[model samples]
Target chain A: MTADLHTLTGAYALDALSPEEAREFARHLTECDVCTHEVAELRETAARLALAVAEVPPAALRARVMAAIPEVRQLPPPGRVADVVPLRGRAWRQRLPYLALAACLVGAAVAGGVAVNAEHDVDRQRTQAEQQASDLASLMAAPDAAYHTTAVHGGGNATVVSSVSQARTAFVYRDLPKLAGSHVYELWYSRKGSMVPAGLVDSGRPSGTAVLAGAASGADGVGLTVEPHGGSKQPTTSPLMLVSIAG
Target chain B: MRAAAREEQPGAPRPGALETLLDRVSRGDRDAFESVYTAVAGSVLGLVRRVLRDPAQSEEVTQEVLIEVWRSAARFDPGQGSAMAWIMMLAHRRAVDRVRSAQASADREHKAAVRDHSPAFDEVSEQVERRLEREQVRRCLGQLTELQRESVTLAYYRGFTYRETADLLGAALGTVKTRLRDGLIRLRDCLGVSV
Candidate 1:
C-alpha cells in the first residue's frame, strides 16, 4: 500500500513529479511523516547550493537596472501612478552588502555542491551512480592507490564504457565523445606514483589515437579527468576514471 | 553607510521606475535610461554577483542583462507583475546561463575543492546586513520552516536546478519543489514581492 523509499526520494528531491501528482502529494505532506523528514533533507541540500555561487553585485547594478525603466510608457510616473499606491515599507533599508551576504554564500555553495550527474536515464542515474560512488570510494581508499579518473560520457551523448583489462592490468574507455571547441580530455598519472596525475589525452576517440603515459601500467591504470578549456599541468581533483591496466 | 543604523530606511521597493525609463531608453530617452540606471542598477548588480562566480563574466552578463532590459523593455507588461520581478527574472536567467556554461562535477568533488571557488555563502551572509534586498530576503526566509528556507535559498542563491538539489540531498524532487514553493511563499509574504 505504501510507496517505496526510492520512489519517495526521487519524487521529492528530484521533483520528477507531474503537476497533478505534486499537488496530490503536497496535500498529504501535512500528515505524512515520510514526507516531512525527506523535505528537510532536500531543503538543507538547497541551502548548500546557493552557497556555491560566489559573485554578489554591488548596489550600482540595481540603479542601472532601474534607471533603464520607462515609466511614462509603462505607467504614469511614480507620482502619477495609475494603479500602484506608491507603497515603500518602513522596514526597507538600503546600504551595502554586509555579513548576511557571506553567510548566504556558504549556504549556497553547499547547496550547489552537486553540479550535474553525467547520466540522466532513471535506472542508470539512480543505481549506477551508487555503484560508481562505491567503486570510486574503494579505489580511493587503497593505501597504494595511484591516480584515478571517474568515467565521463564523451561528447555529452556518447557512452564511454569504462572497462578493465584484467590481463593487461589497466582500464580502457570505448566510445569516448569527440572534443569540442578548445576543450580536450586530459589524462593524469598519479603523483608520487600513487594517483597524483599522469598526462593529457588528445581527441583520440571515434578515430584518432590517444595515450596516457601508461606509466601507471603497473600500479593503477591511468585515469582520465576533465580540466579547464586547456588541461591543467597538475591534477586539480580526483580523476573521472580509475582503471587498472588489468582492471 | 551604517550611520543610519537607527534611522528609518527609505524606498526599499519603489514601483514603476523601471518600465517608464526603459521605454524612454528604447525610444532614445538617454536621460531616462540614466535615471533608471541610477535606480535599480545596484539590485541588478548584486543579483548578478550572487549568481555568477566569475567576475569578468559577471560584469559581461550584467552588461547583457542591462542591454536586454533596455532592448526588451517594450515587451514588459507591468499589469502582470512588478517591474522588479521582471528585472530579477532577466538577471536570474543570465546567471543560470553562466552556471550551466561551467562543467558540472559531483557535489562532493566541489566540497573538497571548495578552496578553488570564490567567496563562500557564509562570507556573503556576513556582509548581507548592509544590503537592502538581502535584509528583505533574511526576514522572509525567517518565516519558512528550516527546510523550506534552505530549499528556496539554494534554488535562488546557489543557482541550482531542482534535480541537482535532489541528487545532492539524496531526497525526492517533489519534496524539493514543495519546499521551494513553501519557502518562496513565506518570502513573498515577508518581502511583499508579488511573485
Candidate 2:
C-alpha cells in the first residue's frame, strides 16, 4: 500500500487523482522528502506541458483580471504570527475544531461518499475556530489541509491532519489499545531516514489528541512505538504503527 | 541541470523576472502585479481553456487564477520550484477544480449524456506565442512510449483522474501510474528542469 502511494507523484502533480486520493497523497508528502522533490520536479514538467499548449487569451480578459486584483487581500507569508500554533496546549477545548474535523474524517473511512458534508463541516469549524484559536484555525483552514488514517498494530486508528504549507501535523488516537505498566506510546518523525522523538501519549488514555513536535515538512514518515514513561531518545521497540508517509 | 543557464528562448519571460515581479507583488506593488499578470495571462488562459473548453468559463478562470496569484503571492516559495511552475500549478489546479465541480453538478442532475468523453490529445493551437517551447515539448513528448504518452496527455491535458486515464487507455491502474511517473521523469530530464 505504501509503495503504491509513492508512485503517485506523477499522477498527483498532474492533478490526476480524485480529490480524496489527492488529499491523501498530499498528506503523505509532508513526511516524504523523496516524493516532495519528485512532485516539485514533476509539477514543473507538467507546467511545461501547459506552456506547450499556451494560447493568447482574448485581449479584454487582461483588463478584467487587473480590475479584480486590488479588491483581494494578499496572504501573510508562512511563519507570520498568524501561522504559528503551540505544538500542543494543555487546554484541550481549544482543539475542538481539530477534533470536529477529525470526526468528520473518521466518517470518511466508513463512507467515502460522505466527504462532501465533511468538507462543509470543516469549513464551518474553520469559521468558528478562527475567532478562538488562530493556530488550529489556520491549520484547519489551510488550502492544503489533508488527513490520513492508519490502523495501529495493537488496535484502533491513528488519524493525522497535516498542512505542508504550515509545516505542521495534528494527530488523534481513537480507541488505541492501552499499554500495561509504565509503557507509553511515543511519536517519532522519520526525518531524513532517522527517527526524531516528537511527543508521547499516556497509555491509560483510550483517546487523545496532540500536534507532533518539530516541523513536519520533508520528514520521510511518522512512527509510533512503545517506550518507557518519559520516552526514549530513540524508539526502543518495533513501531506498532509505522505510517509510510513517503510520497 | 542548471535551468538558469539554459539558452534564453525568445517570447519567454527572462529567467527570474517573474520571481522578482512576484516579490514586488508580495509587497503590495500594483505595478508589479500588472507586470505579473501580463507575463502569465496567456499561458494561464491557454491551459485553462484547454481543460475547460468553454471560452467564457476559461476567461473567468484565467481572471480568477491571476487574481489568485495576487492574493497568494506571499505564499509563493521560489526555493521549491520556478516562479513559472508555481503560477502554472495554481492555474492548472484551478482549471481542474472548475471542471471537477462542473462534473459533479452534471452528475447530480443525472445527466448521463453529459459524462466526460476523452477529447483528442495534442490539439496544436496556432496562437501559441512560444513556438520554441512548443517544439521542445513536442520533441520530448515524442520520445515517450505510446502508453506513457497517452497516460500523461489523457490526465494532464484532458483533466482525467488516473482511474479515468487508465480506463481511457485500457491499461491497469498500476501500469498507468508508472507510465505517468516514468514519462514525466523523462520529460523533466529532457526539458533540463533542475530539482
Candidate 3:
C-alpha cells in the first residue's frame, strides 16, 4: 500500500524528509495549491519561532562580518544589464522638454541679473554644466531612478532625479536667482507635515546639480528653500520649489 | 548619520526594513549589508546555537550562513518569503549539515557528557515550560502533546530526518510522521498563521 503523501506536509515544511520523500512531495505539491499554501504558512510560522528566540549575538561578530564583506564577491543582479540604458545620444535629447524648460529658466536667470561675467569664468561654468549634465544622465539611467520637474515659484524650474531603492537623489536646477553672501539653496524631503534637510546646492551657478543622502520611499515630496550658507538646520523661508515624489 | 538614525529607534527595528536592506545588499551596497548583518545576526546565531548546542560550532556555522547570504543575495526574491525567513532557512540548513556530518559523532559525545552532568529532566522541562510562557510561538509549541512536541523538536530544531527522529524518540517512522503533521497543524492555528 502507498503511504499517504499528505502526511509529509510538516516534514516537508521543516525540511525533515529524506531526499526521495521530498521529491515525492514535490510532485504532489505541483497539483495541490492547498498544500502549497499550507507549506508556506508553516514555514513562516517556523521562521517566526526562530525570530522569537533571538538572543544578542557576540559584539565581535559584527566586526567580523563587516570585515569579511569586502573580500566576498557579490552575485550580479539578475536580468540583462543592458536593459538599464544610460541616458545618452538620442535618449539624452528626448528629455528636451525638460531641457527646454530649463533653458527658459536660464533666460530668466540672465534677466534676473545673476551676472555671467568673464569669458574664462563662462568657459569654466560651461564645463561644469556639461559635467553636471553627464552626472544627471547617469542618475537618470539607474533602474530605480524617477524624474520630476517642477517650476520655481517665481520664474525658473528644477528637476529631481530620485531613487528610493538606491537611497539617493540628484537635484538639478536652472535659471533660479542666486543669493548673495552666505546663502544657498537647500533641499528638503517632506513626509507628512515635517521636512528634513537632504542637502545643499550652490546658489551662485546659473545651473547646478547636488546629490542628497536620503531615500524618497517614505517622503511625500521634495522641497527647495533658500538657506544661509553652509545650510540651515531648519527652513527659515518658504519653499521656492515643491515637487510631489509619490505617485 | 546612520548611527543617529538608529539611536532614535534603539533596538526596535522596523518591519520589512531587512527586506529593503537586502535589496540594497543585493545591489552590493556595503553599508546596507552591514545594517542587515547587525539586524539579523542575533537571531541567526540564536537559531544556530539552539540546533548545534555548541557555541563554538554555532558561531562557525553562523559565519558560513552569513557569508552565503552575501554571496547569494541576488537570488533572494521578496515575493517568495520575508528576509528573516530566507536568512533563517539558510542558517538552519547549514546548522543541520554541521550536525549531520561525520563530525557529529564528537558532538554527540559532548552532548552525552553534558547530559550526564545535568540536573533531572523534570527541572529542565519546567524551566523550558516557564520560558515558553513568555513567547507566542513557544506557547504554541507548549500546546502540542509531549510526544508530538518531541517528534517535532527532534526533527526540526535538532535537524533530524524522520528516520533519525524515530530512532532518537524510539517510535516508528509512521508515528513520527503523523505526530509531526498534527503538531504543525496545531502550531499553525495557535500562532494564527494564515495559509
Q: What TM-score quantifies how close candidate 3 is to the native fold? A: 0.55
Q: Write the per-residue lDDT of candidate 2 for residues A98-185, one digit (tens) a residue.
A: 4333323322232111123656756764564343233443444343444445567788666555566778765656678878886678
lDDT of 3 by residue, B138-185 (tens): 688899999888988887777889889899889999899998888888
lDDT of 2 by residue, B1-195 (tens): 223312333322221146545755777877557646544666787788777776656778888899989998878876677778899999989878887896643533354233342242111111225555777899999999999999999888768889989998899999999999999999999988765
* Residues A108-185, model 3: lDDT tens digits: 222121333568766875676565444444443233344555567766666665655555567756567767776777
The true-versus-predicted C-alpha distance at residue B142 of model 2, in Å, is 0.3
iRMSD, per candidate, in listed order: 20.5, 18.5, 15.3
lDDT of each: 0.43, 0.67, 0.63
Chain A superposition TM-score per model? 0.27, 0.45, 0.44
Q: Candidate 1 lDDT, tens digit per residue, B1-195? A: 212211234522221134434544545554445444433344455555565544545656776777776666656554334444456667766666566654522322344233232332211111212233334445556767877666655556556666776676666877776666555445544554322
The DockQ assigned to candidate 2 is 0.22
* DockQ of predictions, in order shown: 0.03, 0.22, 0.19
lDDT of 2: 0.67
What lDDT would candidate 1 get against the real structure?
0.43
Q: Which stretches of candidate 3 lie over 4 Å from their true place?
A: A1-3, A27-31, A76-247, B1-16, B111-134
| TM-scores vs. true structure, each candidate | 0.39, 0.55, 0.55
TM-score winner among the candidates? 3
Task: Name the runs in model 1 displaced over 4 angstroms.
Answer: A1-247, B1-16, B102-132
